[model samples]
Target chain A: MPGVCASSTQSPLEGKVSKVKWPTYLSLSLVAMILGVLLVFQFRVVRYIEQGVSLGRVQELTVELRQLEKEKLKLAAEASDLSAKLQQAGQGQAEAEKALEGELEKARLLAGLVPVTGPGVEVTLDNPPANRGWATSLYVIRDEDLLRVVNELRGAGAEAISINGQRIVATSEIRWAAPFINVNLTRLVPPYHILAIGNPGNLRSALEIPGGLVEYLQELGVQVKIQAHDRLTVPGYNRPLEFRYAKPVVKE
Target chain B: MWLGVWLTLLGLILGVIVGLNIPMVLTKAHAKYLSVAVLAALDSVFGGVRAAMEEHFDHTIFLSGFFANALLAAGLAYIGERLGIDLYLAAVVAFGVRLFQNLAIIRRHLVRGIKRG
Candidate 1:
């Protein structure tokens, strides 16, 4: 360590202190101070340089991402427009096909290529001839059985269905009339006639679906059979559509 | 480097997990088929766009290869899902194929394009 003392005399201090020692100490301290100042400035310079590089890269990536996102949005808009057009075209084609199918079916019936559709199958269920006890009355078809058959026929795409010639409309009720069941307002006895009008193949398969209508009915010892005809029309149910009770209240 | 390869694999896995969880992110009524179709279409379009952009703008082998691999995996996954095939199998095969395909593309780009540059 060099002391801060210095002589003001013009005389050479060489005698008190050697020339090399004082100058050497002064030069070394000056060098160290200069280096300290440079280091502090260097730290700031390095920090700014790093920030510049990082920000430039971030900006570049951000621009690239924005452009990519814009392109994606534009392409998506175009795709949605195309999809909408396709949906409209598909719907139009489906409606036209349905109309043509109906007309063709009618024409086939007129030509005798299809059977006239009328009162569907009549199923009459009677107590087992040997099981003459009142307990055998339980053998009558239950609500679940009727529901299963109706559901199966619906799944098979039956256009119009009537149980025992009673037209099953959207609101038709099928329930037990205490000794016999009334399907679509028509009272039917055991050995029930289920008149379903649809594709015979599909209808039969639907009716015979495993663990479906057929399986349930058979478990109850009810006899089941299907007869297909080209046209079997059931009389329309007389229930009126009720919506007055469901009207929304207006908030003024 | 093998590190790059591993990173790429990790990215793909993350992308898939995130993709599967997107419905949770975006609540909307979307049929699975429709979403899958859209995903496939976007993948194809992105692959093509990336290729075109690379060829026209960057002309870089690595960037183009990444885009191509991403597109292939997305496309195969979509097709498998649509056909009712195992989606995970499709995705796995897609990853391997994409890696090899991209490597080949990179080799070609280096040999045919970068050598002169």
Candidate 2:
């Protein structure tokens, strides 16, 4: 049967290639081309996933952050309204008005409601040079470092403190929120500028003291810069202070 | 054999240029499905090449196999996801093994043809 088949038919198995079909060649080539395009797209998608959050998730988070910020602004306006009302009510009694005004001024200062200006020190923390290898977490500033620095400043008699223009009130929290540093719930990037209202000499000497925060941060390869200015201004806290639980005791 | 290879290469070059110029953004959730489909298509192409070398290539079979394999791979991935099982991985492993097998056969055919010449 094999011999009869070979003799009767000119088979492709005999080594003489058959004439190629143009349509089949075209279709196969088209399919291969599509596969090539898909391969590139797959590589891109994998890389994007490895780098960080998905594009859709990023967009969703951004929108949420914006909405929260708007709510914060609205609450801040309401607090200011209450403060103005309190000031107007105090105007009714002339004899006790002077003493009450003085107390109100002191309360405003402590609550970070009034902006402060004084001779103080400015500390700047920046990411280390990129050539030092990008993967190491030590080269970047962390939340704990910022907290330590703020605590040291307060200990050295800093009347007011602000990080990247966000005032650090008594209720303020400094934390790491993944790819960002959140100070008083506001997101901050690298190259942080921490301003303190205090005696310039005292603040600078406190940071530069042996085994202090500055030295510790330097050991971690973080760029730290300290400068004293004759006059510096710190903004008031922007968020509203809600006092829901505490009430002043009434004496008969 | 050389004609098919040349045609494939030309198509790839053209496809790359077109793919880069157009922005084809797929959501992150659906990226895995496309990836599995691509792998299945790749396996089918290699199988078709091996069949052609063995003198049993059929155009209809090749076309049908290409689409069917890709769709089935993607479907399996989706079903697996719904079932909370990694079904895409199964497709990946299967296609990967078959791709290597087809590649080995094609390599053997080329080497034998070279030695004969």
Full-model lDDT for every candidate: 0.52, 0.84
Give a tens-digit lDDT track for model 1, residues B22-117.
332211212222333333323332332333323431212223332343344445556776787756465455444543554455466657766777
Model 2: CAPRI class: incorrect
Instruction: Compose the digit string of candidate 2's lDDT tens values, residues A138-246.
Output: 5678899899999999999999999999999988999999789999889999899999999999999999999988999888888999999999999999888888998
Q: Write the per-residue lDDT of candidate 2 for residues B6-81, one digit (tens) a residue.
A: 9989998887777666576676789999999999888888877777787766665667777778888999999999
Best by DockQ: 2
Q: Work out the iRMS of candidate 2.
A: 8.0
Residue-level error in angstroms, candidate 1, position A235:
2.1
True contacts kept of 2: 0.32
- Give the per-residue lDDT of model 1 (tens digit) for A102-193: 99987644433433454333333334444556554556666567777778777877666656656676557888777767665666776566
Question: Interface RMSD values for the candidates, listed in order?
Answer: 30.9, 8.0
